[model samples]
Target: MSRRTPYFFLLPAIVFLAWFMVVPALQIFYYSFLNYSVFSASTFVGMENYRRLFADVNFWWTLLNSFLFILVTPVLMFLSLVLALCVRNLQRGTKLFRTFYFLPVITPIVIAGIIWRWIFAEDTGIANYFLSLLSIPNVHWLTEYPTTIISIMLVTIWRGAGYYMMIFLAGLALIPKEVEEASLIDGATIFQQTFHILIPLLKPTLIFIFVISSTAAIKIFTEIYIMIPGAPMANKALVSFLYQQAFERFDLGYGSAVGVVLFLITLSFSYVNIKLIEQRG
Candidate 1:
């Protein structure tokens, strides 16, 4: 009885996850092989949905856009690390600075997105107002694809950097002071210490953040949707494509196919991350 006690304590969470996550994921996999939709009766149509998925040009574009979004992760990693370092080295107002920096993360995404929408607005936006200070033309930020994507990407960074910074700060705090003292006593420069000793020690934290950020980037929908409501089909995120197909068009089967692909991609990427980490170990 004692040996089984820990498992009992964990059982509720396991059951909860199985009921909510595993079951729904399995249903999506099953639906992807069917011709299920709201308007029509479901029928088994093995691989037909996937065939349609591959054949769709919009899907390819969205996939490419998703990959492009992955670039946001490394940029996030850098920004977060810098913020963490700055906060760590501060002698005063540490808690205040941390709270201010993390303020965006706690803000509701809808409110943040809405506020950013105005910031990126073509004519009356603050962004253009600032650009005008430099004598640059009024760029149609939300209207143009190249700039529109970049603007949305910036919003993501704005909201996410603080969260990642918190993680990095926690990791930095766990490092022993002895390690830094030893390095300093060896006459290591600040840059050398950071690159060689500190960062290398924070490898696990960095890997964890990378995995999390990359997954979020691939699954990004709300930020893109809220920022660029009128974004063209070719620039939509993969999840946006799935959302439109499922909810808007009522093509649940095809959307499930997309979901299945996304699931596989995320799974494979996580596996690769783990394998790389293990190999390094």
Candidate 2:
């Protein structure tokens, strides 16, 4: 085949990327430097929007919340790996278990958010009812600061764990059966084999999950938007803050500045993950 064949095949994808992702991202970056709003004429402000963004107390708080939200990454990685291991050795009905686990992934985020919102409601909610049965005091899951954050994190984990579990399952499937058999013959315990052999081999998948889950955690908006429509002080995420600025308040330039900052933060995280993987390799 001619060398041009590969380029020909990639042309459509390249064009799509340039037209959609690259153009839109460039526009956002340009807007970040302006004093643009829906109601006002655009004017070049040369980083004034970014300066104001950095100085704003609410912006700082939302950024802090975004970082705090990333705490869910470890929990998600651990639980997904554990679930993958449990299902990995199953001899029968594995498909059924996988389907059930992935049900949450396929469920629409809006629906999940609404359902969780009601579940965590202070009054006439199933969560409080269960707690009442256990003789525990009613706790406001979504009305308070840390509790609201935790509740959103729980919903995120529930929705994301199955997807990561599938990735882990694929990684596990790639392990050589001969290596496992040799370890078994050496009288290595299941724990020893998993910790020493399986986990080390699964490093790439772990890194991927870490990067993806961390990015998703940072960009979380729809869940918070749906769960707390007005985004009360306790539940405001960075993206929701951006949404409020751009759409609600018509501060388009400021919102784009927030978007740029978020992009940089997520890019840094992904870069760090890639570096760690490279060093491990």
- Assess the local accuracy of residue 157 in candidate 2 as a C-alpha lDDT between 0 and 100: 92
lDDT tens string, model 2, 26-119?
Answer: 8989999989988879999997998898888889888889888899999999999999999988899889999998999999999999999999
Worst 10 residues of 2 by lDDT: 228-237
Candidate 1 residues 29-115, lDDT tens each?
999999988988899999899999999999999999998898989999999999999888899998998888888999988888899
Give the clashing pairs for model 2: none
RMSD of each: 1.8, 1.9
**Using Cα atoms with residue i matched to residue i, what is each candidate's TM-score against the true structure?**
0.94, 0.94
lDDT of 2 at 277: 81
TM-score of 2: 0.94
> Relative to the unseen true structure, what is the C-alpha lDDT of residue 163 in candidate 1, on a scale of 0 to 100?
96
Clash count for each candidate, listed in order shown:
0, 0
Once fitted onto the true fold, the runs of candidate 1 whose alpha carbons sit more than 4 angstroms away are 1-12
